[model samples]
Target: MRYWLYKSEPATWSWDQQKEKGAAGEEWTGVRNYQARNFMREMSVGDRGFFYHSNEGKEIVGIVEVVKEAHPDSTADDAKWECVDIKAVMDVPKPVSLEQVKAEPKLKDMVLVNNSRLSVQPVTEAEFAYVCELAGVDPEKAMKG
Candidate 1:
């Protein structure tokens, strides 16, 4: 499974709000960027993502699993836009802040560090594993949960 990252403002969609959606998950809609939408199209069910709180906490607070593949975004008026459904998997034991990520040599090449504006972006397996390690989570076990 591929790894990804999803960013959201805490006031708009916090980690707690995502967890409240439960197993049914929630459509990751309202993404207007073509590149971000394309990334959603590439996702498949069971792919894991880091739920990062942007603007406020600026931290990887939790994990999410894609429950549905790309589909017409319910919130979008244009047919060109699409999104995936993701459910909360588990919380990051130790929230990994953006500052911490940037300071870590291993994550220096991460897309998040380079392109912080992208709402949805790809994450390398090595970066994902290392971040999980920093967050005190086992990547393998987190996926199983």
Candidate 2:
């Protein structure tokens, strides 16, 4: 399955709040950027994502599973906008800070390091695996459906 990184400000949507949503998950909405919207459209059910707490924590705090494919965002006025539903899978054993990612030689080419402002971004499998390793979460177990 494909992997992705989704960013949210802790003040707006914290990892704890996401976990509270339970299996029904919640629609990832309010993404106005075309690139970010496109990334959401590309997401499929069962895909994995890094739930990055931006602004406040600036770290990958947990894992989320795409439980629903992209659809018209309920929070939007325009039909062009779309979003996906994601459920919190588990918390990272150790949160991986942005500084830690930038300092890792193996993650030199990560999109997160290269483009810190993108709210939704694609992540390579290798990058995903390495992040899980750094977070002390088993990638194999995390990626399982």
Candidate 3:
């Protein structure tokens, strides 16, 4: 099971919106950057990603799971890009803000650090576990309601 990070602004579509979407999930679309686009194409059903809140809070708020494979991106016609389905898994008890993440030396190499604008990025298992610990949430508690 691979892990990834997906970003969204709070006003447009926040963690709450995803949680409210319930089990059905919603397409993760509107990604325009080529790098972000590539990440979206690589995502598969059953893959998990961090539901990160960018622009507004700039923090890692919760986790999400991909429920469907890649498909056309709604933002663009002609299939210039694609999107995938991701549903809210669970919120971190304590949000790991960009500030907090940057403060930790152990997380210095995180994609959220190296690539600030990358909407979709990979996360190592060690980084994931460390984040769970920092947020005071069990990794197992992240996948279900």
Query: Clashes in each model (backbone N, CA, C under 3 Å)?
Result: 0, 0, 0
Can you write out model 3's per-residue Cα lDDT over 23-50, one digit (the tens) per residue? Answer: 8999888887888878777877777778
| Tens digit per residue, CA lDDT, model 2, 9-98 | 999999999999999999998898999999999988999999999989899999999999999999999999999999999999899999
Which of 1 and 3 is ahead in TM-score?
A: 1
Candidates sorted by TM-score, descending order? 2, 1, 3
For model 3, give the 10-residue run with minimal summed lDDT.
136-145
TM-score for every candidate vs. truth?
A: 0.97, 0.98, 0.92
Q: How close is candidate 2 to the true structure, as a TM-score?
A: 0.98
User: For each candidate, what is the lDDT?
Assistant: 0.94, 0.95, 0.85
TM-score for candidate 3, please give it: 0.92
Which pairs, if any, clash in model 2? none
Top lDDT hit: 2
Predicted candidate 1 versus true structure: per-residue lDDT over 98-121, tens digit per residue: 999999999999999999999999
Q: Which pairs of residues collide in candidate 3?
A: none
